[model samples]
Target: MSGALARLLGRAALHAGWIVVVLAAAILGGVCIGETAIPPATVLQTLANRLFGAGYPLDRIDAGIVWNYRLTRAIVAACCGAGLAVAGVILQALLRNALADPYLLGISAGASTGAVLVTVAGVGAGAISLSSGAFAGALAAFLLVALLARASGGGTGARGTGQIVLAGIAGSQLFNALTAFIITRSASAEQARGIMFWLLGNLSGARWDSVLSAVPVALAVTLVCLWHARALDAFTFGADSATALGVPVRRVQALLILCASLATAVMVSIVGSIGFVGLVVPHAARFIVGVRHVRLVPAAALMGAIFLIAADVISRIAVQGQVLPIGVVTALVGAPVFALILLRARPAR
Candidate 1:
């Protein structure tokens, strides 16, 4: 027993250390590898000068590029990645399905619809504006899904797995259709193009205010998730088993789902609906750290940060001067990985 525990600890430590290093490297890479290509030392000095009074003066343009653009973008990417991954973890546990994710739950579709409507209607414009619309849409979707699931499962939050999945699928299709209808009928071609980019997820316009807000919120949500890790682990054995172990199966399900939806909505509001980070990262983290949510949640968050920041970096550099949408890159990567996971877990006929 002691030997097994030691080995597990060692592996957890190694994974945690690597995640930290990767995050640091990613931050440096983000700051230094842009069009300007600032050196790492210069990036550090500029940041130090801003934070501390260590008077190392940099070219104003270089400082602005590092501080105003790349750093902000990287922070936002990390926040989005971490938030989405944890949301996936919570959702997969709540729904008792490995394949569950925010995008799968119709939350992303609802958020996208709301944000698109806000933009199209010219409701608000600025760093902090569209989030309200996105949150509203996400909440609406959550309620719809819950209602549909409950109705299908005899009007209770303790919905059967099949009912919840079906509800999510139906709700997602409905919201997505509504979004398409609104865009096609109400938007100009240019507006439609911009809206499509947002739907596909791009972080090129990320700013410091967004970073400041998103990072803290994402971290807070992750902490909340971690607090419920034991309950989540209980959930893996099915609700009946969990209930036997004194878990409040229904209440826990509702709480975690709501929290996950809120986190997903917040991320989508900032960077548009970047898919698969939530779906793919948690599963990958589970592979590395096992099914225990205590280890899985933090690992997933760190891996998520690394994955999205790396993706953002690739999106920035893949096209000479033009940035590709991050959702496109993630989809290309996630689709094949997801297929592989499903294949590996394919049940015996």
Candidate 2:
């Protein structure tokens, strides 16, 4: 027993070390590869100076861009990716649908509408911040979807799942239409252009403030999901089966779904509606780590973080002297994968 326990501890430590190394490498890559092309050695020097006071003399401008701009953006991107991917895993587990994701509940659409209201419709009369408006809109959309689901007799069953999905679709459409209407009626060309860019997922505005807001939410959501990992595993066999296995079906579902909603809301509010990280990364993680939630959750989070950082890097370099929307890059990659997954999942004739 002692030898087995030691082996387990050693293995766990190894995995943790690997995760840290991979995450650090991805972050450094994100910081180093940009239009300005900061060298990796300088990037390390800047980090050593700021983090440890190593007194490495680096270019002031390079240090400022690395410490203040790229590092913050990379960290926020990682947080958004991890949070969204975890939310996707939770939703997919609860709903027993491979297609379920963070945005399946209309959270993203609602956030967009809220942002448009603040920026275009003047809903808050210039008092409310964009992120605040987006968060409120997300919550409102979720509440409306919940009400609609309940009205349609949704619960923990196949029929319930269908009803909830339909309700989400309805809610998303309603919010999306409202956003389009507001943009068409109220926004000037410049405001319209800016809103469109943001709606398509721009990480250019990410700063330390964004990192401060995102990191806690991502960590909290990941921890909560990990704590309830067993519940999620049971949920894979349906709520009825989970209940039979001594899981408090209703309480677990409510708690986890709420976690996913809040996490999604916070991320969308911070980064706009970047899709596919949630939908694609969870599936990829599941493929790599199998179905156990304990392994799946952390794997998903790690992969999601690295994936988003890479996508952001691609977005920065994809166009000559211009950045593509992060969403476009993700979509361009994810849509084809999504189609392949769907095709493979189709029942054999």
Candidate 3:
């Protein structure tokens, strides 16, 4: 038994190592192919100056582009993708449902609703901007679902996962309608543009301050999720069985929903709604490695980073000189890739 345990651990570690290497390569590849491909030597120098503050003398505009523009955007994209994917794995595990993702559960929609509301209604400025509003929106959605879940005739039964999903669907439709309404009612051109950009989702607006704002939320939420991996593993066999094995089922369920909400809200707030990374990356990670939550969570996060980074790079080059919204590129790439995967997985149909 000890030897078998060792073997399993060894296998998971190997997959994790490979995934890390692949993700690093993809990030570097993305840096290479974007709008202004800095010469490798200059790229190194620019990066060194930005990170270590010790590169050769650099031009002001070039330095600004490297330090102020590209690196932050790339990091934010990677962070957003990773957080969503981690949240995806948690949802999938909790519900014992393969199709579960953080956005699919309507958290992203709720966050988007909040951002649009702020843009339309005109909210606070500076530090109290979009991300806070989006977080509040996500919290609202989670509370609504929680309330509905416990109501009589709702999904409070043994498998409350279905109830949660139905609530998410309802939330998505309602918020989407609200978003369109705000867009239609917009008096100012900038308001409409803000709404549209939030829906389309991109990291082009990533600021160092905003990126810093997101990092701790993302990191704290991820740690909370990581701590609960064992509970998630127990969930695979169903809630009752997990409880039978002394897992605190209700507490874990609430924690998963809460932490995932925080992560999703912050991600959507900062980067808009880059879809399919959350949905696709976890499944890809699960396909390559096994579904053990320990490896699965980090693997999904890493793969998601790579997925978004690569997709954003493609968006840059997909059209000559025009930077398409990363969200659009993700859907365009994700839909066909996911379809092919599903087709391949189907039983020789």
Candidate 4:
């Protein structure tokens, strides 16, 4: 037992270290390859002078390109990727459905709906332009789903899984209708364009302040979820069993739901609706470390960060000079992989 435990820790540490190295290298390489395509040697020279105020001289253009624009965007993508992936992991665990995803509960649709209403209705004004509209939308959808399940008699039983999924599908469609109505009723093409782009997701507008706001919430949620990884494992065994083992199943579920939705909501608000990171990252993590939450969650987060950074790099260069929407590239990559998973996952014996 002692030897086995030691080996597990050693493997976890090794994977975590590799994730860090991959993320760091990707960010550095991406920054150098942005619009100007600065030579790596010049990038190093410019980076040194800009950060430490020392090495070789660099013009303001390169400084703004590296520090102000590209670097900030890459960093934000990494954070968003990790946050969404953790949310996906939590949701999959909570539902005990390999196909369950953060978006399935209607969070994405509701968020997009809220963002659309605000953008269209032009309501409210404040220091913060986005007033948890997306988060409120997400929470509302969550409650709605919970209500749907309860109304359908989905309480603590083996018979409820179908009803739960059915309710989720209904809720998703309802929110989708709401989003479409707002966009369709618009008088001008500009509003339609805005709504369309927002729904599709993009990382072009990543600001330092957005990163500051999102990173803490993301990190906190990830830590909270990690601490509860063991409880999550217990959840896989069913609620009654988990409770019998002294896990506060209800409390843990609520806390995890809030943590995940909050992390995902805030991420959606900032980056719109980048998909696949949350879903694919978790699937990839599952392959890497099986279903152990402690092994799966952190590694999933890292994989997400790396995946999104790499995706963003592709988006940057996909169209030569014009920048493509990062979300488009992610979906293009992610959707097919998801399909493959569904096709290849073995049927229960």
Who wins the lDDT comparison? 2
Residue pairs in candidate 2 whose N, alpha carbon or C atoms collide under 3 angstroms = none
Quote model 4's TM-score: 0.88
Judged by lDDT relative to the true structure, which candidate is superior, 1 or 2? Answer: 2
Top-down TM-score ranking: 2, 4, 1, 3
- What is the overall TM-score of model 3 with all chains considered together? 0.86
lDDT of each: 0.84, 0.87, 0.76, 0.78
User: lDDT score, residue 277, model 2?
Assistant: 83
TM-score of each: 0.88, 0.91, 0.86, 0.88
Q: Positional deviation of 64 in candidate 3, in angstroms?
A: 2.4
Structure candidate 1, residue pairs in collision? none
Please identify model 3 stretches exceeding 4 Å from their true place. Answer: 1-24, 123-129, 146-163, 347-349
- Tens-place lDDT digits, model 1, residues 1-349: 9999999989968976986787888788877886557899888988898899688978888888888888899889998999999999988887787767889889998988888778776556544367777877888987898789888763323447667778888998998998898899889999889888878898878897788779887888888888889899888777777899998877888778777877887788889988899999998998888999988999899889888988888888888979899999999889999898888778989
The sequence of per-residue lDDT tens digits that candidate 2 reaches over residues 136-169 is 8877887898799999898867777788788988
What lDDT is obtained when candidate 2 is compared to the true structure? 0.87
Summing lDDT over every window of 10 consecutive residues in candidate 3, give the lowest-scoring window.
149-158
Model 2, residue 4: distance off in Å is: 5.7
lDDT of 4 by residue, 1-349 (tens): 9999999899978876887788888778877876568766666677688777775766778877877777778887888888889988987777766656667767777777766666665545432245277777777877798799889898664556556666777887888898888778852688688667767777777878877877797789888988999998888777777899899988999999888778777888887877677777898888878999987888888778778888888888888777777788998999998888777676887
Q: Model 1, stretches more than 4 Å misplaced?
A: 1-21, 122-129, 153-159, 347-349
